[model samples]
Target: MKVPVRKQPSWFQVLLILPGVAALVVTFLFPLLWLARTSIQPTTGHTLSLHAYARLFEDSFYWWVIGRTIFIGLLCVVITVPMAFPVALFLARSQSRWRGTLTALAIAPLLTSTVIRTYGWMVILGRHGLINTTLVWAGILAQPTRLDNGPFATVVALVEILLPYGIISILSHLSRLDTELEQAASLLGARRLQVFWRVLLPLSVPGLMTASLLVFVLAISSLVTPQLMGGGRVFVLATEIFNQTTIALDWPFAGALSITLLGFFGIFVALYQRILQRVESQS
Candidate 1:
């Protein structure tokens, strides 16, 4: 018997994909090229230079900002992953009627505007706002303290904003898990915790890792939440880029900063891919 050869992609298929390709070129490729060009240009001269990068490396303030951005991103991922795990597990394992309701509640924040949500957080965490007011009323403190306009509030708002994404990523993997593997583990004298730690967690590592990356990317790339919550006190790379571009009108400097931010994000993505590939190969 002869094996059937697959047909090549037809003209229609090419046409169908052409629009998407065009859109990508227009929306992403062109801008990326432009950014690359701009990053090397000097502010005073038409000729390209490495002055921006050299200056960035030399500046202690820039280093501090970059360090803080990475720290906050990692911290947000750490906070989000553990919290999201429970919600995802509940969504995956339970057949309860409240599952849908709980899931809706978890995701409902996503429907609201991020700016509005940040504002809400501002109200909640502010010195005279809900939390502090209530605490003071109950005599928990002598006076209300400033929670708004700080790094803590920035992370808190980011956690609240990005929680659903982590839950969804893990939930997708959890939903597709083989129940029989879990049953088999249970029959093999493994306790519930043992089965989870060894079997479920291993199986779910890809999803967990993916969710963590998503959280980190969102947290690091985030401008609005950090700006609002930190109240200009938190000087992240994105906010600095915004300042360079809009406030300072330094396009070349902004481009260089953008390149730096992209480089960091790329490094993170590469590290995760390498680690995840090793994990997958072992599994």
Candidate 2:
């Protein structure tokens, strides 16, 4: 049997796509081009130079910042996946009437502005805030301890902020899975733990990887949470870029930093795609 020939798009079809294409070009492509152009330009002259990039590379402090950023991203992934997995699994498998409400609650964090959520965390983690107040009242501490403006606060806030993305990624995959394989494992004398470890977990690797990638990328690129929670102490790439552009008035260096951040994203994306491909081939 001959396969049906695909039809070419009509003028009307092309017309409908024009506005979206134009918007993408205006919003994303043009800005990206501008950023690339700015990254190479000299601070004073319009002449192109790699001075900013060289400066970034030669500085040990910037290298430390890069490493710290990567560490934070990895840390967020490590914390988020374990916490999100159980929630995603429950949401995927539960037969309860409140499943909808539970899922909604899981994603409800996204509805609020990130700045608002970060401030909420500030209230909870501040020196005289809820945690310290309770600890002091209970005689657990002699005085209220400082919690905010540190790595601990930044990590905690980031984990909470990125948790929803992890849940959504894992849940989408889990919900699409064939349940029969899990049942079959159980029938073959496998215990619940054995079934999960041997069967369900292996199948869910793709979803876990996706969640990890999403959380890591977001964590590294995050500025506000780290800025507020870090209280100018935490220096991630995003915050540093903000400082370079706004405070330092080093537009070219800021552009270089932005480019470097994009490089990190590109490298991780390539690595993840390769790993995902290998996993898919094996499965």
Candidate 3:
């Protein structure tokens, strides 16, 4: 009897994964490693130290900024999710010819640069701007109430940017929903609201959670919209990092801030994954 030889894996298939692996190593892993190294390097002392981290903890202001970032992210997601669901559900259920156009309209904001969008928001919500002008024209306000450079302005702009993500996430889930189950619920004498609550909502937990996580991550890390819309009043981790890196010429402090923000999101992601896995297994 002859000894059989096992066939080796194909090189072409292996080549396909190599590019992606290399990109992750180059873009993500190396940057993270560099940041960690820089974070440990003290500015004053030649040696590596944790002085930056200690200073961050010693300053309560940094903690407040962290809270603000999270709060703004939460606020944006909370407002966007409910609003996005109806639009997403409509997109999924509608058979109208104009549905494509409507969907495009919903997603159009994302096509433009974020800075341009923020500037557009400034014009619309500014003191002497469109909203004020229109309201003044309508005799609604005696003076143009300034929402320019405020959190409300930032939230509004962020909502416009973030809503598409939420809508798309929910729409994807809605499209894959089992219509037979919905029909069964309908046949069981469940009204529209009852059918939605008892069927669609339960099925959509995964999508909603995913959307929330994505929106939160994006909103928290975003720099331009907050910078322009916040008008320097909103001092977030990103802006703080910008200041430390560019303005103060402090790389170590910036690295510490970067790692701190990264760690928070990393913990958030880990917890999210664990919870998601549990929910999926239970389901």
lDDT of each: 0.93, 0.97, 0.90
Q: How far is candidate 2 from the true structure (C-alpha RMSD, Å)?
A: 2.0
Query: 1 or 3: which has the higher lDDT?
Result: 1
**Model 2, span 130-218: residue lDDT tens:** 99999999999999989998999999999999999999999999999999999999999999999999999999999999999999999
lDDT of 1: 0.93
What lDDT is reached at residue 239 by model 1?
Answer: 92
Please write out the lDDT profile of model 3 over residues 71-144, one tens digit for every residue.
99889889988889899989988999999999888888789899998899998999999999999999999988
Cα lDDT tens digits for candidate 1, 214-237: 999999999999989998899999
The TM-score obtained by model 3 is 0.93
RMSD of each: 2.4, 2.0, 4.5
Candidate 3 CA-lDDT value: 0.90
**Highest TM-score among the candidates is held by which one?**
2
Task: Write the candidate numbers in order of decreasing lDDT.
Answer: 2, 1, 3
How well does candidate 3 score on lDDT at residue 78? Answer: 94
Candidate 1: residue 273 Cα off by (Å): 1.0
